[model samples]
Target: MKEITIYLFLLFAGVITAQTGSGEYSIKNVDENTENSDFGASFYGEKMIVFASPKKGVSLVNEVWEENGQRFLELYSANITDNGELYNVRSLKGDVNTKYHEADATFSKDGKTVYFTRNNYYNKKLAKDKNQWNNLAMFKATVNENGEWVNIIPMPFNNVSYSVGHPALSPDGRTLYFISDMPGSLGKTDIYKVSIEEGGYGEPVNLGDKINSPSKEFSPYIDGDVIYFSSDRPGGFGKLDVYASKTDGSVFEPVLLNQPINSNADDFTFIINPNTRTGFFSSNRSGGKGDDDIYSFIEIKPVEFKCAQMITGIVRDKNTNMVINDANIILKDVEGNPIENLTVNNDGTFELHVLCETPYTIVGEKSGYNPQSKTFTTSNEAGKITKLTVLLGTGEIVENEIKPEGLPKELPEEIVKVRPSTYVVNIEPIYFELNSSYLTKEAKRELDKVVDLMNRYPNMIIESGSHTDSRGIEGYNLWLSDRRAKSTVNYIVNKGIDPTRITGKGYGESQLVNQCSDGVKCTEAEHAKNRRTEFVIIKM
Candidate 1:
């Protein structure tokens, strides 16, 4: 019923803003070109990566494209000195860069990997065949032991559908969110997410109507607890504007940049200088040499704060103990505020940083299995690093028989149109030991359905509710039910859904779809049906 706010990235060229107070943005032009243009910037601490002039002598090739009447730009990278000067700007060499068009470079949190978008024709018969027309797929390169990047590969998420580009890696390097105009999109392009699995990529999920519009939104960045992206939606300082949004335990809403920060020109593709709190973005406004130029700004800093007690770890199966890909992992405070949401890779590992000296709940889950949730208190502060391990069980026994009622029959018109195009994540149920909450093989079978659901709705919120038969004492049953429900939620949340979206509720034999009571002889099938875990969409 209410219109959902979305963000669209607009490409422009200009510079705006002056440093406030004593804060100074160490500004530098990564590329020096008086006759050409360069932009689309990304940062990894001090090092910088971007795209720039593709003219002869400046680039390895000598070819360009004129969109409206001019040539499209190329990609480049540079290093930032300690004093903030950028130099050694050069075109990306090797087989990755053709003479067509390339831009938007991103680095992994550990700075060991790089991902960027390229547009043009390449002769990759196996890889580039998906989108032959607009072969704008994403590619990656990893830092080798010799300190040089090697072995570039195309991201698996790209296909023959629409174009995919503008990839941004999460601070933990476990999640990657990018833009695509694939078959399922609310607008010209939509933001999508996929897990970094064992050096590969899992399936991609659309970020939903909240972050995408009928216009266009691109260049996403995930820092701390907020997501920053570019858009040309209404009420902007220019043809394209920058916006910020926070994870409010549910969906997100666009928060426009304050006055003076956004101009009436084209401003888009921005990155924050992590070390200095300064902002670096690109624009196509006046005073620039060509179509676009890079700019820097100083952000208004709040009261100073530093993180403590950083928790990091790996997720694996209890038996056979292999890394489970795309497992949801979550860290939350006692009040249910999500501290971090992480998804494990095919290698079954994750990392999280937070202010310590408090208590926390760590949870993990995958499809076709039961969740694994545990509690651990942090005595370390932000700087203190802690490592932990989590194990999950597959719920194979109960998955085949357990089937809930159908989904809501009535659907909104807009939802119906987009819903079919969206992914449907399915997690199987968790099998408990006979008459016990302890997890078993059957439990994991059911949990897999939950993982599928999460993959389907990257922006939707979920609530995990636990139920039980009327067999034990009211108090005991309530506690057991709570544990069961929490256990289910923990498995997937730990796999990496926002813990805030998932809260466990234990009815303790309060609500029953069937009649089975305490101390009464009942068929195993009847009790099995009563012992259940369910999830609901709280926000779209």
Candidate 2:
């Protein structure tokens, strides 16, 4: 019977992942009801969850169907703790539970109306299909003044020949999504939705290929723009991997979630709280207490962006082309207020953080070189770095003089032609952990300096070259290095540097600086030298 098939799928479709978003999560079984299956959980109230369970001696009705010697499914309520643990489990009161089946209940936004799946049974008579087995159907109920569900009625679309169940309501309660095997379905079972009007329900419309594959698609849940569901189609971790898709009107293209959300087992019936970014789902995967158990999860947060707008470059002697170390670099705002006094590094390089969309004047001078000043503006473009090369000439040291208020300063006499100097400076090598492109704290700190340099020299272009240790295969190392290079560049770009000013390349183990090549034993430090990132000036 179709009801039997649906129950069998619920028992088998078990899968899960521990985390889903910007925070770490701990998942655990709701309770120790290991002897019987418990799943298809949905939020009941603020701190309670209503789920379907088939534990022995819990059903109130006598006309129960048995599968594997287990009682038919019944709706139960349980209180969930803040830490995602379940306790105080009990069955639903009033006339909601029956002998045939009652499960997969979803509530309206107000929690006053409930739509659920169950067998078509009324007045102690079961609605059976041609094979003498009952067919699954959807029903609705509303809470009365006595806090009990009254006015229970079967959906108008229910039929004995075909099955229609798994009801999920939209946030506004204006639309309902469900799974059915009625005529014109794309597969054995496909998801269908209908508009709920004040008068009655509209005709069921198939969700189409974007959602319903030739393989069965069911257990539809919507939160904001995303629709979460389960599918047994190809390219999944197992028989039924939970999938999510961004809903654009009536269309959706689902993407299969990776482990540990999906395993080599069936998983379905997912529900979540969008505000807390946490929820529960059922999985028949290994390491559970029951045949199918409800597990809670929270999503893990990702790395935060910390890089800021920066400028960096070297100060050099124009005639001699020598690095000018310890240069007094003064940065001033557009109104001539001193912003910062920078100390040039030994390599004649200086880096400074600057505000975007503001103009600043930079004055660089060594004890013996003439003071050189340049004016530039930081653009509003994000993640861009400006570069600059201050070419100071040999001349009589100029003294700081204060002019009379409102007086024009004297201009310097024209000097003979002086050639601009050019020199190469090696940046500190960026190190990474083995076989990963993720930016380490140290790596980010180092790239922050580069961001300052690129911000200072707006017209300068740089190349990020990354290499890997020789421990892995050359091809794999190359791929890893490529990702590392891009990762490094992306970090700098995210700091407000222009992406066009930088490029990345991976050398793999082909450009080792030491004797840590393949087939050669070397110390970890030696191999580490090869796994490095370098920034070279490509254009100025």
Candidate 3:
């Protein structure tokens, strides 16, 4: 009866199918799953991946459910190796673990609070409704001073007549989405969201018809503007197919994830970090060590955004700090193909409406001023104004030559010539520490000079280009340098500089000024020369 109750109560937990595909994604099964039923994987902090299993894991107490001849599910986290292997798997500490079911955990941004799915059992007792049927309930816990999760409590919405489990939280932690067969559900089980507020949980809001089918919709995971879930709806490749619905508050159409990721089995609980385009999902497709397994996927091709957006730009003189009425602005795609030509008004502002998720560059040129270009990317979101500021009439400065008197005098030769018109801030080549994107103290101090320079030159706009010495693989260096670029931009933005005034790009080993290309024997100093932060003066 306990095993039967647990399986039925796990309304959303199930299997997924798998088939091979082209370059869009590459999928591989991980060692997180055991011979028993292991599923419900979520990233727990930086170094650990947490999930649930019907095996005695972290807690020493493993209570088997006689009906299935297997132990009930418990939350277990394992260390993730650099090469993406699982190690040192252990059950989660604290009263959160129980003889009943505990799974589908989501962590808050601060990592202070955790919410998970557990059987109605709590406090050493089983909770059954009027018919003696044990249902699933959502519970919350917090880490004590000793780092153990204590203070376990069921969510206020938990009820005896209905089951609520498979919890997923928004990154902000303000909205909690979970699967339930509670009152007013559209199907046997539907995904519902409630506002997580200061006082208590807000009223549960149904995700509505767009996402909920008459069959079922469960295992909801939010990644940026998209909501991922699985359903046995009509037009899918398997019994359950994972679908991505473009959601920005209101729901859009649900697009099924294609072959390789979804097969004729049950695929659900998809989670991803959009920035890295790498994530984990669960599937029971064939060739697994268990009934269901967690698989890691890497997106070789990014999902395209179809939403339209408005991009605007304002052109001004870098030296005079005045709007240029005769400025010419050309919008080009990431590949440098011209898409739209904008005519600047006498007021110096131009606007272009285009689709989101594609990177564009705005080139501003005037008869007297040197032509300049500013690059930016649009989003899949709505009502956002992607704007750019073009500063013209600033002549290119020679490396180690044009030193503003206001700059710190100790660094007189503070520039490096990257290109004809591009100058890189040569305060230090290695702006970030080794193997890390975090800005160092010296990097911050040098960036302080940039904040001051921008403050002095109101129309001044700069582009931060992060570089890497040819030591690591191409993909890794590109990712690391991109992180470095964003980190530097964030620091300056936090210092009260307008985000629009600064931009960032990563040139991983592609723009090396020295002979330290990959496989080339070079000293640490020579490599450091190639691994430098390029603070290029886009305007002024």
Candidate 4:
């Protein structure tokens, strides 16, 4: 008999909103946020987002919940922008927006089915159990071509005796994840999941002790096999904090998210699009305009949650064997995407707290020197220090001709210099369309040359760095360039090339061939040189 108290938000809904309490990333409230609580954001379709709020944008319902004096929560839908902002706020269409409380919803992959949370209001009346308790329940609905939720039906698993709400569907739309306070719950609430289909539902299974702490756990969101939820358990920032767990069969090991995502106040209802690495979460942290506010953020770095280690590496000049503290360092994953990039420490040494059992590459770059790279793999053991070194050197550009044994026959035999002692096949320049990351047909044609070359040389490794002209916002240009590099690398990987043999990153507008500075007058042809993508042979 858990009572709806202040900690539980008086039955308003699952977790919501965030503030820049620590400011590691950019986060702002949704456009429709008001003085009342606004939280529980979920994607309804490709271009729309549906969330729970009391703003009452276009709904006719006027009833207020006696439990808290706030208007009953209603589901609202809005257009999502390319930058993850919200607009065109309106009440969701259809009879699903009832007079009773409605919050926390999840949609199927095809955008046709939705599972939502509400009070156990059935038969046009409130349904209570023998204990005179109004339990929370979940409902199923279908979306019509008109964008309205139709065919509303109570889920078969709903029971008047216990509460079940905060629904999230699995990425494959095969299982439904949710929070409940059923008979065997470990706390006031626990996350549960069950196989679901149009025919019926399977028995709910508790997520287990790892995710279900003795304290309350709610607001579950699933992306692939990973689950994100909010809990008021021990060892958090303070009060409720968002936690993530990777599921291995029925077992899970939950890890607490870092600050800025979790603050001293309540933070929950976390959701993310893995492709773009952008997400939204809810929080009641201070500095927000309302009781709770939804926040949108871009992931500057991905959080790793495996065995940990402290990796130390040094950058130096290959010829002089002297430390180079001012050199730029780029850390890459096995697949060759930049994981972290920065200048090494003043001591010429850089340390990274990284995941164990992973392969990594470190690239050292200096203005006057040719780029150099070193690759290493972390051990499975934790708390050990490993050493790696990168040395950069330059050589005179030579016009001599040399044909490597495994080189493609079509490539010109003319050789350009490579890091003091190598000459390799050249890949044509890869360019992109304006403000776009998709690979143009010409870019693919050039990439195929590199792919064929790699297939011929199994020992060779390459790095593709994409650049953008200094035409748009600097930050946006960087993000766009990263996308372009990723697309190019992905295309090669899809064609038989091993992902570990290639890595890439976007340099954005940082490296321009000419002095096409932002404030300077420059021709489109000159700027176009800055938009080119370069694929350098890192190892051969």
For each candidate, the alpha-carbon lDDT, in order, equals 0.61, 0.73, 0.74, 0.75
Q: For candidate 3, write residues 1-540 as lDDT tens digits.
A: 443243663344333344332226778888767777777778777667788887563534347776556777888988877656688988899889877778889988777899998888787878788778788888999998887899998999999788888888886678899988888989888889999888999999898876887887878898744688878776777677778775553223466777677877777777776556777788888898887788878877644333465656677788887888877788898999998776799899887776645687777888977998766665433334555667787632111234323344343354555432345565655455567888778888888888877787777678787888789877678778878888889999999999988987676766666677777899887777766676876565
lDDT of 2 by residue, 173-249 (tens): 78899998899999878889899999999999998876887877878998754578888876677777788764443
lDDT of 1 by residue, 1-540 (tens): 111011113433343342122112333432453445566768854666555555445322224343423344556667665544467877655445555556687887677778877652335442334333445778788777765556867777666555778888876687888988788788777788888878567889887765677767877877644577777666566666767664221222465665344567766787775546665677666766666677666665421222244556777677877777788988888876778787876677677765545677777877876887767665422234566667778422111111113334554322222121121223443435434766566776666666666566566666566777777666567678878877888887777777866677666675554557666778888877778766645455
**If ranked by TM-score, best first, what sequence of candidates would result?**
3, 4, 2, 1
**Model 2: ten consecutive residues of lowest lDDT:** 414-423
Which stretches of candidate 3 lie above 4 Å from their native place?
Answer: 2-6, 9-23, 57-62, 249-251, 305-540
- Where is model 4 more than 4 Å wrong at Cα? 1-24, 55-62, 249-252, 308-540
- Residue 482 CA error for candidate 1 (Å)? 27
lDDT of residue 289 for candidate 1 = 63
Once fitted onto the true fold, the runs of candidate 2 whose alpha carbons sit more than 4 angstroms away are 1-5, 10-26, 55-64, 249-252, 301-540
Instruction: Report the Cα lDDT for residue 496, model 2.
Output: 87
Residue 213, candidate 2: alpha-carbon lDDT: 77
RMSD (Cα, Å) of candidate 3? 13.0
TM-score of each: 0.50, 0.53, 0.56, 0.55
| Candidate numbers sorted by lDDT from highest down | 4, 3, 2, 1
Model 3 pairs in collision: 15-266, 16-265, 16-266, 16-267, 17-263, 17-265, 19-260, 58-91, 238-264, 429-532
**What are the per-model C-alpha RMSD values against the true structure?**
20.7, 22.9, 13.0, 13.9
